[model samples]
Target: IAEQFVNTDLGGQLGDWLDFMKVMTLSSDRKAAQPDLENQRLAVQVMTIHQSKGLQFPIVILPFLQSGSFPSSLKKHPIINRLPSSWMNWEQDTETTFRDIHNREERRVFYVGVTRAERELYLFGPTSRQSMFTKELESENPQPMEIKTMNEHQDNSLSLSERKQRLLADLNREIAAKQIDNARNILDELEKADRGETADGSTPKSTSREMLHLSATKIETYDTCPLKYRLKHIDNVSERKTRATLEFGSIMHAVLEEFHGLKIAEQTEENLKYLLNKNWREDAFEYRLRGEEFRKQGEEILSDYFRFIQENPPNVLKRESPFSYVMDEINVKISGKIDRIDQDGDTLAIVDYKTSKKKEKAETNLQMALYTEAILRDAVPGVKGNPGKANLHFLRHGDDPLSSHQFSEQNLQDSRIKISKVADGIRSGSFEPDKNEFNCRYCDYKD
Candidate 1:
């Protein structure tokens, strides 16, 4: 739409038009165009206080209402706070402290949440002691209301195990104490329970299990921490965070995928820049500053990538190829999308892109091994025979970007064995948390 408008009104000024569009999209006026969800459906809606702004519902249930958790203590960003005020152009307000600002925002959020309930508003918190805001809200009402316990209406179809009961108790305790991380962990435990997972790292005797399905990410995640893998892949509990690096990597992958689809003659640095410009997402990053920083980094990486591709134009056979291979021994199916594949002489070459900080070795990389084996087994259409080479194209590494290695029969056999072992563990429900510090550092379920 911007392109069409630019062509018609601005005489084909695409770059300027793109800048204008971005500015307008980021402006506060964009919220006016948001679809009203109040009358859209007759189902119960679950949303955050921010999402509930300017919208009302028939019933609003505000769960996990605790002092520190709901209002959230005034916490400053370590890096941002340490930076000079002059550098950030921050103006210090002598009258208002950081805590004041935090309190005001929290109060506004609570107010919005309270007003969202048209007919009934259910506020849940600790029975022993309530949140500071809860006192203020209750004081306004001043009248006694009927109370109910959570376990009054139990479903006949569902059975609450002792572990689940303990988890529920723990969730209540954590919320009362305003232990946010502990509450999240308990919530994950409850989700696992709902999915028929036992607390003792064993599958239920009554439940029938299916054949294990594996992907490169699944294998790697299981290897990193089985509990994390089970929570993410099995129970489908995603980590809630707007990671700038992941967002940048996704944009890079999308742009490169589209760029590689073009003819070799059409693949130029200018075209690559145009692709980046076209696909750049401002909302993906948590902060606008970080987004701008990544945008600059993207241009540099793409410039290097464009030069490298021009110098050694690959015989590209396929782009973003999806393949599924079944392991006969373990009866486990492994599936993933290969970034690119090149016809290297008599054999095929599997190319996988990476935006990781560290370059990966093809010999040790399970993804490369899996992709190579899949192609060799004729699992991927239009590709056959043993892989001549496996390439890990590290986009972040300006120097020594490509890591190429040829897989031996022994390496392939070992990978299969590894897969078999992982499958066996998963099949038996061995999702015991790996408590390694390195593995737990950036884990979503970390407490």
Candidate 2:
């Protein structure tokens, strides 16, 4: 392309084109990512399965086909809850047993990964710890090209925790040997032994009597998946993958808090942007480029929020307000952070900023009712007369419209009853794993 421009004999035109291209490239601030695709380039190539979807290769090697490496744990899929489960048509090898949608997708991707190699294909993983396709591979009786460790036949008596650790260690060593391609990820996992906790950074004590404080989230986790709650709160297990969205939401909340905390004189666009930069997090995003994009997206969301405020600014009385109350009915403490409290005429409105694209089911929103009850009884500073309304500000939407949930005596009472029941259920110490699978992977427990 440069040669074509040079051959045009337009003297300064080629130089102008080069300068323009340079500016365009630099404006994005994204570093060089793609490798030279030319076959004669004589450089080792690497690409993710999704990236190589329609592309073919002369020789392809797929690493880490062990369980949880490809299909991932079914207990928590980012896209699973986007739509209702009934709409999905289950795929299966034999029609009798319904297949997991995520497992089916993984199988299809594995096929694609293998078929890409027209000449030769290689797969690397621990032979004893194969993923979903392990049973089929064993039935076929295929031989492995290499064995990294001596524990070819794992002992049956080994504890589940022990087995998990061994497998994790093996995967890491294997990854390190494979040109240390994923060493950073491995290191991050290894460094997680001391991390993963509740928002307050408290780990669950083995003694039930020690746990005097139980938040709404804690109760919700137990109700949704008991084993998950045990692993996360009780045992404290380490998470395998980074929760980008969770971190993204946290950063957004911090920025919003800062935006509200500022005085009117200090609430300029530049100052707001500075607060965003101060609260900006790069660790949550998958890559630096994505982090940059997220920061920019955050700024845009904030701008939209600011515009909304200009049009219809409610009297914000509190920012990132904390409220803790003991549910005397259940004898458990339910606490949560109310994003904002605003005075709407005669009553106070509890507002929460929902960063997610999906609106949380209004009926299932126990926090709103819980906060309202606290405000009405406790006489929270913002509530002038009666504690009534709650607002969910969805920042992602184009118009930044508010979703309001009005408080009714019956519904509030019902919410209290539900909370009490859930609290009692948890206090009973019965934790059943979700039918799909154990949600240990996504849990904050890292024992």
Could you give candidate 2's per-residue lDDT for residues 1-447 as a string of tens digits?
A: 343333332332335667756865787775756655667325556788888888877788888777667656556556744555444565743333224666787788887787788787777765333555543445555555654432325433222343234435544455646846466654455445333322244433332433347766776777778767766665544344445667788988998788788887776778878888898755455444556777877888888887888778768788887777776544677677788888888888888888888776454577777778778677354444577578878888749457778888888888777776666556656556665435444444322
How many residue pairs clash (N, CA or C atoms closer than 3 angstroms) in each of the candidate models, in the order given? 0, 7
Q: Given candidate 2, what's the lDDT at residue 243?
A: 53
What TM-score, to 2 decimals, does candidate 2 have? 0.51
> Residue 346 CA error for candidate 1 (Å)?
2.0
Candidate 2: which stretches are off by over 4 Å? 1-212, 283-286, 379-385, 436-447
lDDT of model 2 at position 289: 52
User: How far off is residue 33 in model 2, in Å?
Assistant: 48
Give the least accurate 10-residue stretch of model 1, judged by summed lDDT: 143-152
Q: Return the top candidate by TM-score.
A: 1
- Rate residue 275 of model 1 by lDDT: 99
lDDT of 1 by residue, 177-251 (tens): 799999998898898887676665456642224666889889989888888887777655556444567778889
Kindly state the number of residue pairs that clash in model 1.
Answer: 0
Number of clashing residue pairs, candidate 2: 7
- Candidate 2: Cα lDDT at 285: 52
